[model samples]
Target chain A: MTDTILSHDDLTARVSRIFQRAGLSPLQSDAVARTIAAGERDACKSHGIYRIDGCLRTIKAGMVTLDAVPELAPEDGAIVRVAAHGGFSNAAFELGAPELARRAKELGMAALVINDCTHFAALWPEIEALTAHDLAAMAMCPSYSSVAPTGGNEALMGTNPFAFGWPRENTDPYVFDFATSVAARGEIELHRRAGTPLPEGWAVDADGNPTSDPEAALNGAMLPFGGHKGSAIATMIELLAGVMIGDLNSREALDRLGNFTLLPAHGELILAFDPARFSAGREGNAMARAETLFDAITGQGARLPSQRRFAARKRAMAHGITLSAEEIAHLDRLEERGLDAVA
Target chain B: MTDTILSHDDLTARVSRIFQRAGLSPLQSDAVARTIAAGERDACKSHGIYRIDGCLRTIKAGMVTLDAVPELAPEDGAIVRVAAHGGFSNAAFELGAPELARRAKELGMAALVINDCTHFAALWPEIEALTAHDLAAMAMCPSYSSVAPTGGNEALMGTNPFAFGWPRENTDPYVFDFATSVAARGEIELHRRAGTPLPEGWAVDADGNPTSDPEAALNGAMLPFGGHKGSAIATMIELLAGVMIGDLNSREALDRLGNFTLLPAHGELILAFDPARFSAGREGNAMARAETLFDAITGQGARLPSQRRFAARKRAMAHGITLSAEEIAHLDRLEERGLDAVA
Candidate 1:
């Protein structure tokens, strides 16, 4: 597909319109669109508007309850639960983050768990919500199986993305978002489309044999980043966000959503901690010292976490985000009509 | 130096004796000795009684206050702060874990922040403290710098160990303790002693060139486990434990403990969450579902995290802990005398 440029506004409006046409309430549609737009602005191409069609497919397949309104469970001390009503995670986060932040600020730390949510997008948005409160935050969410455990052949764990945010001193919050795999599935898909070879150990073929062929990898399972270490971290996320939170495990999510060709009904675990409450009389100086760490590392030619994304975000704001011609066409078709043109 | 086998009880008794000779209060010394015994029993030699000499050295150097009694700060909702009074983290955790567990059980979640503590042991013990309470726990601590940021030669980040524990159904808790580096510094030291080669990307030479020579790695700095992903996690630990907790950072720890040949005055963070309160009608089903994950993976030949250590612990309990001849000699030397023979 040939590439093209779209202004941030145009791209977001089209994504929102697509959601509106898909029968999402305006509030839900806007929340989803804003999250996707932020992803694009920060240059996360895979998780941005590119995922609109997948959302539509799940909706068309009668998997997600479009009209379901997320609700917060009665709160306990420093713990808030958001029942996603089988809706997308963005809206659930929108419903729960403010109260979570308030609780954290009042009581030093707080946790929010989102259940029955189809979390198809990136996880940064939920944790980033606490940035407004100058709070430190982290979030984890597990998807259906795609990555294999170390020394095993089958895919039994999700990429299990983790996102962390820090309230900085007068700068944008320092954020680090990563999938536990060597690379995200979308990056591998890009390699497949380009007919490019993958690095060794990136994935294994269907027979559990390591392969550099992107096509073979697409047929098989992706490998975790650092062999056993990455798989262990991914498994922890699955247990914490999936099993412990009373949500379906990876295999269960895969079984239910497999035929629908949509995302699993994933679970998310998020925490926000107030630095002022934790620090010993050094209020915001933690962030200042964090800046010192950044300087110490970056001055030596080492890049700091989220540096690339922040730069891309700055550039996109000044200019515009670029999209593939295929992505543009897909969005146009979805916006102009409904699922009819595609399905 | 040669290896030898020592009985578990004998080792623990001797370790306790050394701590006694080092001027630790009996309660504090017993806590520290029991932790070291557990480590040795579980075959975590680096974080076991091997650290005793370093403890005495720092204490003799007046870096750690032997008379320091850990005190609990006034409770804040679900948060409990343990003032270690410049003592050891084991004693701090020993003093705080029970109250922390009480709060977690009462309020659904609890966090304990140990300030002014010299934590120079495996992180598992603190997280394991919450295991008896059937709590999901995580602990993060930053050590003196031995790992460098990606693309940098200088060591600015600690191995930055993070350990997590999940209460399992009818089994020992699922525990995963890992340094964010490709290999921990101790592993490299082992390779050096064995005159073995290292894997690529494990470490860099003093000139920043990646090398397979274990000696070069020992001389230089260890690399993070998964390049950028591990580095980011390490940096997060540095900020969370070192800066936000108002404790000496990795660099500062390194400088102060350099002559003692001990780990830096690291900061620790531990949190315990009560899954019973968060799970919707699942009660203890969280651990059962977690067992399902373990089965799916273990059936496929993937080893569960901490399986090896649990086996080692079991064997040690049955037979005895095997220490090296050098290690035994060192312990005997310390126990029979004091810091005089060693320092």
Candidate 2:
């Protein structure tokens, strides 16, 4: 099959049309579409159009309550818990971001806990928004289990994506989002599809021995990046987002949403802190001196974290995003199915 | 030099005598001694008796205020800043712990930021104290610059250490403390002392190329573990502890102490959250279900995060801790010189 190019507008409109036809309200459709489009624009292929089929399958499987609204889940002080009520996590965050920033501003720091949600989009958008208010933000969501602990063999932890953003005075915010696993499962799948071998220590075979065969690794499990240290981090994410929030852990989430392979049942946590509240060097302290840290990076000719994505976002918007033939076909199939749902 | 053995009480007593004679108040001497004893008990050589000489040198160089006290800096609601008044961080934390726990209980979350302090002791002591009140705790302290960013050639970041501890119903609070660099500077120093080779990806040569020679790397910089991911985490720590607290950044800390090479002029942040406030899981929810995650680790015979330290601590308390002959000699020398300082 051939590749296809999509203008930014076209990509979002197409995604919106599919969700709308599948019974989501236009508001929800647009919100979801924008998230995907943003991912594509940033060249985060795994999170963009690639996730549509899974989303569609989830919707068809009745895993998401299309009209469900996120409600305040009885929390106060510096921590706020929001019950997503089985809604799309993107919408939950959209509803909660303002409150989180407001509370953190009033009290130096605040955390948002979200549970009973399906989160498939890239998490950067949720946190990156906080930087606009000069607030530092962090968010984590543990999805389907695909990786194992450092020494243990079974796939027991999710890809557990973590994101952090520190606002600056001028340039784009310093933001980074990454999965604790050695590589995202989608990336490994891509290698498998391309008949390529995986890199060393990326994954293990079914018997728990390290293997570079992408398929075997997929049949088995992904390794935590940075060995034990990364494994501990993944565990920490689970404890913070899944266990601490009283949400479905990876195994529980996967089990609860049976047959819904496209949906990532998740529990998430969001934390925000006002940089202004930090009183050091009011003139040129931590908030202002962040530039010095950046200079060190750029000074060393090293690219800043997420610098690549920033560039990709700019280029993709101007030059357009590309979709593989198979991905394009899947989108079309979903569109046809969406029409059936609409009828 | 051959290794020597000393009982835990003896270790603390020896350290205390040296500090007290150096003009430190007996109270201050005991606090510093207790912190060192705790490290020895954990079999953590880097932070134990081996660090005594450095401590003595720092005090002798007039870098530390032996009679200084921790004072609450002007701050409000849910956040408290403590000025260590150029004293030991252990003393600062000891003074702040009660208020930190009290405020976290009252407000669900509270942050304690300490600046103008010397912090060379193990950090676990700081956070582990929070668990006594069933509060989840996290702390970060940025020390001297020795690790470089992923793409940077120079050591622009500190071996920022991060620590977190979660309280459980019946077990020891699950705790883990780690430095963001590929290896702690102390670990590198050990390799240097033993004349052992460094591990691959652990350090870079002066020209920025990867090297495994410990001395060469020590003369150069250490790599951040997990490559770019760990490096970003280090950056975050610097921003949070060094920059946000208005204390010295890693390089600044290294530069300020001038000829005072033994001190780690640390700016640290300690955060506490009452897990009881986590509303998602009142009974078997996230806060309480952390036990399930712990089981997943120990069930696999994989050691829990701080399990080794706990065991080592127990054994050392019963069987006594060990120090090297050189370490014993240094302590003896310091004890003799302490009389001169007092005189």
Candidate 3:
């Protein structure tokens, strides 16, 4: 076969069907599928169809509640609480985002707290959801305890991800999502599979000694980006999103799961700020002012984060997402065999 | 030649006298003095008495208002606004911190916005202020446009400072404050003064090419920490704390000042979160849960941020702060001749 091309909607529908057949409810499957399709559309392969097997593994292992109906708690002053009930975070985020935007507009700023969720999606999706409402937003969450804190030997903190977004008038919103670790665990696993040496500063061996051997790194711990500063940020995510939300932190999540093969269950914190409300009596228009800043960055040839992803998204929208024969075959298998196709 | 020692109160009084004599109002002098003293007590010499001459230089250049009382805008939802009237940000922060704490408790979260202020102080003091109220807090502010965005050759952003703090029940709050840049502008300047080579990756020359010469680096642009991730965060600070607050961004602040010798006038954003309110219906106590995370960090031999500073603070409290004879002589001259003591 030459290749397969599908529109964004078609891709989403296909992914949703696979999830639905694998036992996920429509509420969870549709929301989760939308994010996976977005990943493919944006050409972020790491988060794209590649993630389906891992998610299905979690489902088959009973680590995720496939039929959960995420519920939003009653109004809680400047806070929108969503009980994910051990389900995927996507549906919970969708259930809470509208209220988050409304509360932020009303209070100048507000936070969405997601509890008891199996979270694995990129935070940018949630960030973009808020930015679509013309708001600036930030989100963070902890994952498996695979990264060591700066100056520590063992893995204690997760490769926690932090994301932020700002709204724009007629362009894609400015968005960035990144792991605090110097490199992702997946990258190390890839290196191991290729029998390649890992990059320096990417990891430490079992004794916390620096190592370039991918195998040693896998048996050891990943390092945080930018050394101590990044480590501090990861720790902050653990405190704010995990501990402060009264949910499982990275260590607790990892301990509960017992292995990294399954998705981790934890809490997430998303804060939204209404630019108009924040700049109510200020001198300049907040949106226009933001444009000026963006111009200065791009004017100097400094590429803004997420530009490549947006470019891919534009192409996908215009032409359609292209997949190889193998990928299509895998999708077909997933659709046919459901959970059995994963493990 | 022996070192001189003085109690924290005595040191604060001495710094206050110098500022008062140099034409600052008692309101501004006292608040600024406290910060300076705190810096010394915490063994942070870079932010200690060393900053006095810089503050006086800004005053001598007629860049700071001598006796402007910061005004607090009426309560507007979750925002507590303070107009610094072109004075130092210290007093403005003092005026709004309590209200920020109160509002955060009432609404689960709140923001303190300080506008039209000359800011040169470390943000940890402000973070500590909120943490004292048993609230988690974060603060960010734009400075002179001296750092380049990642992938850009020119300086289009500031070495923006980002600070965060979490309250602890029986000890110093967890806090971390750092510049987004790889190294501080002051560090580069010191290297130039000492005729030392700049560290690799710290900066680029005028042509945007990497340079190790301190002089060339000073003339060029400083690079951000963690590459693009740090650049994105610095940009976020400019948008949220600068443009969104209706105040000057790094470029505007630098342009208005015309030179980097004086402190940049801009805005500051401080967000306060009441953990008690955030974790109200959750299972565990937020404070106690935070301690568990801290224990894990220490147990693994990974030092928590600010531990060294807290150690210094303890020493200072027990034995007073020690200053070299030359530092004391400089203080005496500043006290005797006021602004005339410096060039």
> Which predicted model would earn the best TM-score?
3
* Error of model 3, residue B275, in angstroms: 1.1
Off by over 4 Å in 2: A1-10, A258-260, A280-283, A316-333, A339-343, B1-10, B258-260, B280-288, B318-330, B339-343
Residues B97-116, candidate 1: write the lDDT tens digits. Answer: 99999988877787888888
DockQ of 1: 0.64
> Between prediction 1 and prediction 2, which has the larger lDDT?
1
The DockQ value obtained for model 3 is: 0.84
Return whichever of 2 and 3 wins on TM-score. Answer: 3
The sequence of per-residue lDDT tens digits that candidate 3 reaches over residues B1-343 is 9999999999999999999999999999999999999999999999999999999999999989999899999989898999999899999999999999999999899999999998999999999999999999999999989999988888878999999999998899999999999999989999999999988889998888999999888889999998888888899999899988899999999999898888889999999999998899999888988998999889988999999899999999999999999999999999999999877
Q: What is candidate 1's lDDT per residue for A1-343, written digit by digit as tens?
A: 7788778887777778889898887767877898899889888777787677788888888888787799998878878888888888889999899999988888888889888887787877666778768889989988888888988888888888988988876677778889998877777888988888998889988777898988888788899987888888899889878887888777888898874368788779898888877885643477677788888888878886777777888898888888878777878788887766545
Clashing pairs in 3: none
For model 2, how does the per-residue alpha-carbon lDDT over B1-343 read when each residue is reduced to its tens digit?
A: 7998899999899989988888887767888898988888898777887777677778777888888888886657777887788888887888788898988988788899887888787788887789888888888878888888997778878888888888877667888888889897777878989988887899998889888888888778888889888888888888888877678788888787663257878679898877677643543755446777787776755567888888898889788888788778877877887745321
lDDT of 2 by residue, A199-251 (tens): 89999887888999998998888989888888888887877777766677776
Q: What is candidate 3's lDDT per residue for A240-313, written digit by digit as tens?
A: 99988889899999999999888899999999999898888778888998998999899888888999999999
Measured over the true interface residues after superposition, the C-alpha RMSD of each candidate is 2.3, 1.9, 0.8
TM-score attained by model 2: 0.93
Which docking class does model 3 fall in?
high
Q: What does the lDDT read for residue B175 in candidate 2?
A: 87
